[model samples]
Target: MGLDSTPSRYRRIVEEHFTALYGSAFGRLGQVLAVDAAPDGRRAAVLGEIRSAWRDRPDAVLHLVDLDTGATTRLGDGGDVCPQWSPDGTRIAVATGGAARLVDPDTGAGTPAPPVPGVVEYLQWAPDGRQLLLGVHRPAATGGDAAPVVTGTGADEGARGLWIWDTATASVRQLTVTGAVWEASWCGADRIAAIVSDRPTENSWYTATLTLIEVAGGQRIGYRSDRQLALPTGAPDGSAVAFVECWCSDRGVVAGALKLLDPATGTVSDVDTRGVDVTDLRWPNSLWYAGIREPETAVGVVSGTGVDGDPARPAPASTEVAPAAGSRAGEEIWSGTDTIGQFYPAVAPLPGGRFVAVHSSYARPPELAVFDRAAEPRTVLAAGHDGEHRVRDRAGTLSYVDWSAPDGLRIGGFLARPAGTGPHPLVLHVHGGPVLAFRNRWQLGHPLIGLLVAHGYAVLSANPRGSTGRGREYVDRVVGDMGGADAGDLLAGVDAMIERGVTEPGRIGVTGHSYGGFMSCWLVGAHPGRFAAAVAASSVTDWYVQHFASEIGWFDVAFLGATPDTPGGPHFTRSPLSLAHRVRTPTLLFAGADDTGVPPVQSTEFATALAESGTPVEHVRYPNEGHVTRGQRAILDQHARTLDWFARHLPTG
Candidate 1:
């Protein structure tokens, strides 16, 4: 089958089909961040954007969607804000313009509530709705465009801390002075629990502690995990604080380990969650959670936990969810990987066991939906990005495909292939976080993924060793073995597909961002000639360079198990740049101008080495993009470039 891989044709398809649905590198996209169910469940307030965010504030618009009529109304605009519903649901608490306010959901009017020191992220409304607990991130040392994942610095001005805004007095006060606060929640009216670090750098968050800050005075360290902690939700009665703890390579993107702490008693225990890695949590009537159970993403309730279990005895404190043996927990009411109830699988608890989640599937665009524990979901507000369906249909079938690693471990991933496919050229797409996974969550909606599938190139997105959904042992295995078995697992996946008559040898291309980018470069370099072409975006081509340059240097130190200073370390051996001389595949490199996580130098260094090796290589940079390219034009350009690169190399039919 002959395919047209011209830049204009691919660019047009991306603009007309994808730019409208997901977003274009230029802008103009609606995103739903947080969903709050009204007291009556007739309406929900979504905290996000009705327009392009560009990762900048003043893009936040509080949208009120009537569940019955499916009508959406924007309350107002804000600089940087976290929107939360009052207990009574009469008003919404939001922080914008470096200040907090109470917004009338019906009238779209705002009541000022004094000013705070910084931009608000995670927040909570007091039980009585008279106060707001804000997770405020102060400005960076530069005092311009702060909060992105950048290198750690010593006690700079930029630090995330907690704040309390009293709506009654229209005043706000700082809660703590030391240690930057991240995910936070209010405990009753007098206490707050948060994930905090003594340092404000992105690397420090890897070891941040879960602390309980008292509104009365002192803060106490509640629980400190060797692994990362996040999504601390306070029980309504202020009895316990629940959080998801796990071995995470990246902050914000996490899964598994639902642990509860009774602050008064100072007793912390695991909420037996079978084996599922809880990604997000909500403490309503029951300790509800959304997480990944390998090939499936699920939302459920932890029944044996204090809330639903016998209050006479709290669950036993144990590291049951640790790197060893454990079973899945709670009642898995809903299971599937869609973009819903997310701060990454965010679930908004509605009244009477109903939940409203932002839904997106392999074929569906993002939209609001209501789901009961056992019943199928119904859309609340249509996302209006229906153009994706046609692309989905022609993009072929999406399924979870697993293959045995070279070492006998099973590696799972999502695969999309053309309809009439018999050993089609497979495009391996790697996810960013060695910690993140591809859960069939409308990834096909992505212009690049869809364009490839539409062009008869099967896509393989792996959840190989370091990915979540498989538990701590599985994820932590990548720590000292970043280039070892993890690389073999993905290469073995291509072999599995080959054995299954899915794709033949010498016809595959590889693409990824971040660690995936590292792997793409890793594969082409370490295991030469396995891939026909490679596109590494925001990549780490040289571990030695990455350790000194990347924002989270600890990531390299921790994952590689050796410092760059270590003589003859894997940092020197595993880096793609070390093997660049062996790369015969034409490689295309991409990076963001503003990225600090994996600096543009990471890409340029590899490009330089590849040029020295006489291997065809090109480096492309997005001016306004960051670690992840979210720009409309930038993304579109990436799609066109990726298709063009692969087309010139890989065999289609």
Candidate 2:
């Protein structure tokens, strides 16, 4: 065995394989992606189960969960994403493997919808439930399936249009042929609201505009976002349109400012969400929203102050939104730190103010539950009772801690301690996307946090200035600063833990992936001899190389404020590889051979620098993997190597 490898300490990594083989998580239930409520609210269609083999892309199957009895039955055929329940709750439309399929929610029997020219990306049923709107993607020049969009890139890489599929006629017809539509939802049956962009490339999403387009042939501009705009949703009656505007570092993951547009007056009003960034918005009773409210996950109602209340009916002279109690971001119905929604927030709104979602924490495993106004969420489907009970007993203490950074700005993080500890060895777990924040959520179906804690390591997840959850102002602070203040936030957090007698100062280590990986690489070099060991997977070691070769080169311009070709600037000084000469820490690096986002060269460049600096380094590149490590065998090996590496360097027992 390699020096990092230790005796088998934990069970063989089998959760992913178990799910793939038995159709269920081995020690836990399935990870809930999104939930859709039936018409009566007594039943719900839940999307769960992510197999290891399909980790390269997200895949889940639909299931019917009984709210009262807490019983679940999986829908037969697997689905890719965007699961929608028909209005009457009779059928559910799920886009499974690039094809649209309808399954009877009760019987779990499925049938294919009429085929379109392109691959189906999104499925949204009409309000009347007679038809569905499909977001079809067919790259302008690519001749094969949309699957290539995952790895390869070219001009107009993700060009998409809309199609309508009729249930009664069993026929499909084109809806819009005009421009690149990123996201679209029904604005009543005849009209649709969509987020449109001029370019079909990934970076073009940064400057997209929210527009209201008709099914026939008309379009109205709603709002043009300075940052990335997404999730354009319209009211059932087509009275108003709502969408989310945020600075997203990664595609498909969105959460931020909530806005309402009165198409009649062409005026957009900001939705006051009690200061929380809206993640998911649905119009059931009024407007129901789920978002990141810093320390907790909040679900609320947006009511009262209507956006011009049909500003176009009589063409109101003033387009100002009328103010009223609960008119802004609405009222908070339920909130908790442990409740989780995969990407952002996923809730299935019932007929009443209550809703259903998945809940998990350091002590409790994931389970389906119902939430009402100000009441604790009632667990309806507790996963793996025996296994969860054992895990809860072994779970020590999880707390939200904060400390002042070098500049006196208060930085926060979640600290998890194992069974018994006093100054336990610390492992700083950094989250991906310098634009994203680390919140307190259960770590299931993945390595890093959960594995570290079980093996007697205390985890300190720092949410620096760049992370979301904090207001936009806080999020905006990390834009151009990148590795400066954000890095200090983590160092300050480490100091805080040492001062509080929670972790040993000299025994601390660090590990992360993507942006987190970048931090890990930068931290070891910038502060040589600080971290005992470092593991940075799929890391972006050099900004110059990343800006020139990455799929989203614009992301560098947005954060670094300059291109790699720009004489000399942050591109050179901010890169970790430039400082590798001073590094003395033993580091483990990983890269995916097929990762187009960070590219494999990022890790290779840093590995070469480490060897040149005489720093102990081991680099591994996995085939068939992308930016995010998802291959089953790869994840299992990663978990084992990470645990062994940490144990070998920062010894506790």
Candidate 3:
């Protein structure tokens, strides 16, 4: 009845969709991580990974694509290698395995540079192509007073620092004596701009410093502000440097402004971004290009001409220019779509006003596209599968929805409803990051959403108060009140769905991973009667345990304002484990055994509590998996188990 609505049928639907989506000719395109357009504008280099199946580990590869010929060639294996194009477009630099190698774009030939002692964390070719900047990871020696190093979490003891590799002589030299360098860009041949943090911790983003380092003399000129600055790129002439200065209050980045740094004077000036959240800035040519996050996430080009207002003072309101056509100040080259499922769109500028980017919507996989200002965005490489598997029979239509929270704040979300639905069972899917938003991109990580919708279920994915793209104020709402108003915001979204008559009462299930998992646990425990089934993956149960075990334990100080050791702290008061006695819903828990983000102990502790309290619960730990599971088999197993758990506990029809 109603398409069987059984676990076996649900499994079949999931398998069919996963196969149709991954087994198609276009599915081989894989996921594009980074793209760099050559100087000539005739070609581009892409770093992407191909996954043959839903449960297979992705094979990372470097691809050289010809814009004029539309031909693509796969280079050698690129395991987590981020390739960068030389200014002249003759060569590319990438760190493959432990070696930094220079690759010829035309021939796909790689020549090994001098090998650094440790793993390369960051790699970029200098402007002159004579040297490469690298961030290396060297393991600490084992001895008395030497702490054991933790690898995957990026918190290894004195393991990571910056270095420079000379391509001309094949020589390597250490730059920084201590501190972990996250990113570095050459200001010129003799200077480099970089973001350095004390330790590579989970919350290091908040503590990273923007510094201009002299390569020849090893002198450091640091920015004055204490705020987090990122993605430092220098002007071609080395006169100025541009970086995203995250204007964060104790609540996180409330505003991200593109700031210009004078290398000679050590003075910083804010680029009039016209109120847009500038996530990234680059000066590839005479004009400075910025990656915008709010008012629609897209790429915009700004004039590099002199600032009209005072450089040291904040621009008056009158000096600000709105993003409009015919304005030399700034203009969006690519505005995003309002449709659900499109996200993280990027653009790389080539020589002659042409750009290469990965374009896709929620219903479509990413395809490499070329954009010319005069013509429509043309697809250079299309991922073959388009919603062919998502027919009315097995898939639902995705739409954007918004509702007002209890505090009168409007919250946004995406809803995917099954075809021929009438008060169908709904699943509230939460997103992690508490800071991240559920954009319109394809849910590669949560493929089960499609399967669930196909089986007569409705899914509501809400971006509660803490989610990004809503500006700084809304994002800061979750700070120091993690489980308070944000939880209420999620419940408000559920109430809105109920009022819309899209969901049936008493048949709702809840699921999320990481921060979303934490929300799922808190939701089921605080409001047990609202949900029938709950699946929390890599969840944070006790803030106390999270503070002690997580590599990002600093998140406790940032989000909760106190550590677990602080007496009468919010760490225990805000934890979902505190309300474990009230949980009545059948809950499923899954986590990676090696997850230093949330830590496996969080799930284990909660599972023990649930079992002792006689609540129906199950916990599964994926061995060798970290905060995000990259292994194919582990991913498939997680989805299958989650789907089965939901099917057994919640009514699908």
Candidate 4:
């Protein structure tokens, strides 16, 4: 059968196509950072990473994925990510394993940065590129006293400090001895813009504060924001620094806005963030470039320029929807319908003024396309699922369906039901980054949607508020309001599918990871009569306990509107643990042992609660994993378990 005509066999065909393209299904393009052109602009050297990020394997290698020809050259083994070429483009500096490396782009080799034991982080390169800056977690004093990770952060604890390195000399310089410095950028060879925070102790959150430091003269310039901000990117001209600002609200963490701070003047101004929460901040020019959100994704530009001036000024005229004032805008680039809602969208401008956008989806593998304002986008290099081959034999379709919610918000989902099947057992594949949206990029994996469809099962992945791709308001709609609005949206979607004859009500099964896992637990417990069985991985059941154990402590205060010490509000009302008695569905709970973020306690609690309530529940734990399942074996095991659970309960769709 031809690629476009074959719908029933899409899943198996894609698997074969992907295995032929990339050597393994783990060809996950890790991080795309610091893209620049060669001195002559003949070829652009793009620096990126593809590593076992969640797994943290020793073999993780950062590679330079060529934009023009789709050639990938390994940059050697190291913890390298976020590569920045020198002003001369002779060398590329990157955050390698525990340090940094300055490699030659042509040969894919270079000198390594001095290693710093413990916590190592990515900083930025100077405009000259000769110098690199980074943050190294400073160890506690030796002998009598020692501070642990549980203690959190504190002064005198020798928290993560700033460091400067000379690429040419291979010399290192420690800039600070106390507090934590993150999102560091070199303004010039002599100056730097870095965000600093101090804590009374390593384990304290209330004592944290943000500070902007002028590193050239070692000046401590105290600057404050209404909330926490991260990933500060410098403007093209180096006049301002843009960072993400998050605020706590009754609903939960409402991303306030992207703001620009003038390091010289100590002034802060809000950028128009549109309604979508800014996923990334990039500057092709000082005035504007791009901001990315999931679903209906578009690259928008901000044209106006001024200090503390009203960002609400006249909006730019374009087909794109720019962010609102006090927010950031997306790049002035356009991707295809395939990339719109399927995966994370990334863009890098080639040396010749053209741009390359790379995206990956659950329906397809990673692919890169180039575009310019004057010309249409061209697929310069298609993604190789395995080694370096492109999969042209696989084809699929993407559609958005709306399910009504009681909150009056229209919750939508991306459904990739195979074109050939109908009465198939439907697979309710939930998304991971509950804060993220599922896009329409090329996909290859267990082929959740395609595999199920190929295996005679319909697959539906819904966006239950709190999901990105939509504007900020929509994503925040489920903050402290979890289980409140999104849970309703899930049920509505399931019902809608049943009504459309796309899914069998009794044969439906659900599975999700992270926040989706939490939702799965919530669904089985809150509305047990609907789904026959479920698989919840890295989920949270008791919000009260999870809020404290997870690294995202701030999230608890934000999600619940109050901490555990003073509970009993909207958070508890929405907690699935409180509704344990209502659960009737059989469930399989999966957890990662090392996950302090969601904490294994969540799954344990759900299993305990359900079993005690006279419900059948199975708890499976991975020894060394944290938050997610890695390796083809573990992933396959997870899928197998999911399939087994549903097949045992909801058989014969």
Candidate 5:
């Protein structure tokens, strides 16, 4: 049967795979992404999952998790994220596979309302809660699938437009026929604010001008902005919009100022808020934005007033902004110091102008704590599990440690020591995104790490040079260097892990997805004897071919620092094929057939090279997964096979 043909069988296969691979329940369950307060405020609209619910499943169904009783109700067939609670809070609007649906929160039943045939992303409920707005790429009838809007590529095969869908009537309208538009905010029932760019250039994030557009007339008035404006959040009064404006800075554009935009007057001023890039922004009476400036993570509150596109006066200075109660942006939030991992933090607004930040540590599961602003020295609502039995069955201490690279740059990583072991086999878990961070948050069904640990193996996840959370400089460290400094940092992390008594030196293995996959391939080739085995997933074997082959339009130039057509060529020295002769490790290569990001060719080319060199190698490809192996069953199976491969090659405790 096809992958999605039978959910029951798939779940069984995944469970069996998990048991065979992990041999322990480290409590690695699935994660919930979207949550909202119910109308009565007694319960919450939580869209999460149970691990076995859908094995080998690509996307998740919208499930309503009751806050009070922790009861869950599945909402739709599948393919959902970014669910929003209506203003009245009776219903919820969910952005699923390719459509927007309105579901009754109490019943968890939705009226099917599919979006136009295009990629619709970042959905928002209108102020009146009557309509939903989102960004979509509507391709021309003749054109094929929407090509990624890359940096230098001028081909606009799809028309990027603002789509407004009325939930009551299921009527949809194209607000703005602009391709470079991003992040729409509903000012009122008739007016909308969006970031638009006429002449788009390659930038890290969305770099566009804030524009106010009238839905009925298709009239557009550009809000004055010297730099790009993003994360546009409408005020409570629906009169003014507060957003972060990107300014050119010496230390890089990591810092941003809160600005009130006036569409009528075309005026934009720098408000009192000044800090790192705004990760999440919300307006609950006061304009609250979550900012992370590396060593210091703080939330700045701004207040202002304006309407009809008129500039407003700046708010008072933000004085007592602190970390999100239980959040540690630089250290605890991420799993390690050098590498970037995934983190799911709960930002729940509490009573009396406070917020409760709940998440888990690498060594622990989910935990909750309340943050009180009035208390002196900030009292802790809950210090979380006291490192007791919570981690007893866990492989090892999920400790955050740091090390210095050759250039004096501080690198971070997570060292998961084996449960009952002296010196265990070491496995380096390389992260994807190459730019994203790996934070210390709750993770469920982490097959690779959990299975390796259960098998008496020490796992190390490191954020080398290009990882985030440290600073903008650290994220862009591998921008121009790509494989150079990042590879060195990974190597250094392994060396440091061994010196720190985390694992044995001779029994080291490395594995990564996407960019991390490239590093794994590079590691096997660059330092031949350093690792006993390597697993490269959806990696980049040849940069020259990947510039046009990749799905993301801007990734090539943004990461490589040079376009494919540039004089010196595809920029950096990136070719797993060239280093194939040096790989002596028993290697395993993995990829998804449908991965548009790093296509299967990357894995195929490397596998071919290893086989041609007479090196021990194994290759496996999933039918429809994207860059990473994400289907519950697929991921479980991949994890089981990976652990088996590593165990057979690397020395076990």
Candidate 6:
């Protein structure tokens, strides 16, 4: 049963193994999307979706899990949005279609709230639970010879705005007459603070306004700023509001500040975060809880007792608290160590010194974990079962590794290797979201890593300079220099891996999707002799074409710092297609046929270029897919093609 002896049979065996492993892993960890802890923190309402079979689509459902007993009670079908737990913990509100529904966590009974005008985006319970803040979308007004215009601030595409649902009166009132409301929180019984944008563009973060509105009179007071403001959390006592303010350049948020705003006077003061990338702001009590992503992801807390200082006072000294052992008066509660990755781990402060969160690692699936001062994480809901154990038994071992780049910047990544000895054929897998990091979560998006390792290949997934786990400065490094330092950092990581004798020279391959796909194409072209083969899926080839065709075309200007038409700009010089003539490695390109993010034309154009340059290349476009393939058939076919492509180009013994 060697690689060359029975190619089809060998491939079939590999596919079957991968299918079983994927099914087991997928089932073991029910896809927990959002988790909201009860006010008391004794239990949590988990909104998740799971597919029993490959052909089946995931059905959304809510589960009430007892933290102490590990008892999970299914609460009817849920929507594809976050479920809000009432302030008093008596009811849970979820958006379903154009209306909001209230579900009794214990009884599983649902009460339909008053229907809104359009599709419901988000539902937030008022402080007293008498009203629900409904983010909904209304169709754009159209007339003769005019195209329908979509507007609004809802997460979905449309004309989105804010609406108030009065529970007692069973009435709905439009809060904002125009513009899209990004996020809102109740400041008091009669006032609400929200982030609103005049234009409903995808890049609203850079143009939104933070406003305090009187609910009854519709009197609005807003602060005007060019910086991006987000994740606004109102104080429990309604004295102040805190939000994340990001300094925006042509690129995205380069730096951020956790600022406190006085609702009465409209004066904003900085709450010192020591200049870290603070996100997921929550005001549970007198303390402000947020997740800090710089240095590494950890829970950060600051006292809000005196946050509403004098309006004319200079911003107080940095309130940033370092990771400490015990929870003192002003210390932050750091979760576990820096070695593990926690991607936006949700934290809910409990009555005592306890906190509950959904935690996961490279080797661990997400599970409900409770934390305390003892520094030990106790799992309340186990995400693994026999299926998970079976998959883990055959899975490769994962370890964290880091190396200094050419520019003295430290780069980090995770390496997964098979059990056997000697230098192994290596596959350098790149992650997308130039802003997103290669975290320690289960590699559901890149399951091919497991399949390749099972067949005797070392997989190296690196987080280069622009990744988010580091601070904003590190993330902003790739802004105007997308393919420069970041690409060098990746090459340096590969060199370090080979230097450590973990990978065989000249037997290396590369693959990635989205921005990662761009990297894949750039890697093979930039270092023509380095990799034996390349797979670039949903990749951007020419910045000019991508700018006009993609939904996030604005990203081109943000990242490249120039429009496509800019004369002799990096948009053309740094694009992978510019160096396509140098590519010697056999390449495989793929994309979703209907992808609006990185349109399939990206792959088509690159494939055409590679062919014209006499490079061995193959192109695949999955039909009815978007930026990423979703259907089970498409996923399976993609996996098989990828495995078979790698095996053919870089054969293993």
Please, what is the whole-model Cα lDDT of each candidate in the order they appear?
0.75, 0.76, 0.70, 0.59, 0.60, 0.70
Residue-pair clashes per prediction, in order, are 23, 3, 7, 50, 26, 8
What TM-score does candidate 1 reach? 0.91
Deviation in angstroms for 524 in model 4? 1.2
> After best superposition, candidate 2 residue 138: deviation in angstroms?
1.9
RMSD of 1: 5.1
Q: Write candidate 2's Cα lDDT for 1-653 as tens digits.
A: 12133235532443422233323453223677778888678887787864533234335777778999988887744655777888777888888878999988767788899888888999798877899999998866545775553344444465688889998899999875566788998876688999887767676767778878988887867787668888888777666678888888887778798887765666677777787778888764366788887788887776542332221122221333333322354667777777567656767777656788877765666778887664678888766445445455544568889999999998888888887648799989888888776666655223356557766888888888878888899888888878888999999999999999888668889988899999999999899878999999989889988987887888888887776777778899889988988888889998999898898998998898889878888888888888987655566667677777787788778
Give per-model TM-scores. 0.91, 0.90, 0.88, 0.81, 0.77, 0.87
Per-residue C-alpha lDDT of model 3 across residues 573-623, encoded as one tens digit per residue: 888999898999999999999887788998998999999999999998888
Give the winner by lDDT: 1 or 6. Answer: 1
**Lowest-scoring 10 consecutive residues by lDDT in candidate 3?**
309-318
**Which stretches of candidate 2 lie above 4 Å from their native place?**
1-29, 50-59, 139-158, 305-327, 444-446
**N/CA/C clash count, model 5:** 26
TM-score, candidate 6, is: 0.87
Model 6, position 638, has a per-residue lDDT of: 71
Model 3 residue 87 lDDT? 73
Query: Can you tell me which runs of candidate 3 are displaced by over 4 Å?
Result: 1-13, 25-28, 52-56, 140-156, 200-205, 224-227, 247-255, 272-275, 286-295, 305-329, 338-343, 386-393
Candidate 3: count the clashes: 7
CA displacement after TM-score superposition, residue 344 of candidate 1 (Å) = 2.3
- Position 607, candidate 3: lDDT: 94
Task: Give residue 78's lDDT in candidate 3 (0 to 100).
Answer: 49
Residues 489-524, model 6: lDDT tens digits: 999988998999988689899999888899999989
- For residue 39, model 5's alpha carbon misses the true position, in angstroms, by 6.7
List, residue by residue over 1-653, the lDDT tens digit for candidate 5: 23342234333444553444323322332444545554344445544543434334534567665444545567766667767777777888877776677888777777766557577766888766788887775653443467544333555445556777887787887764443665678765677777776642223233456777787766565564544466677654445666665432111122344566555455555554333445556554345555544323344444323121111222222322111212121111211121111242224443334443334455444433333454422212122233323333554667777888978798887777776646678888888767654555443225467556766788888878766555545665777667788888888888887787767668899988887888898888978899998887888887765766765545666566777777655443567777888888999888899887677887888888889999999888888787766676666656656766776788583
Name the lDDT value of residue 226 in candidate 6.
Answer: 52
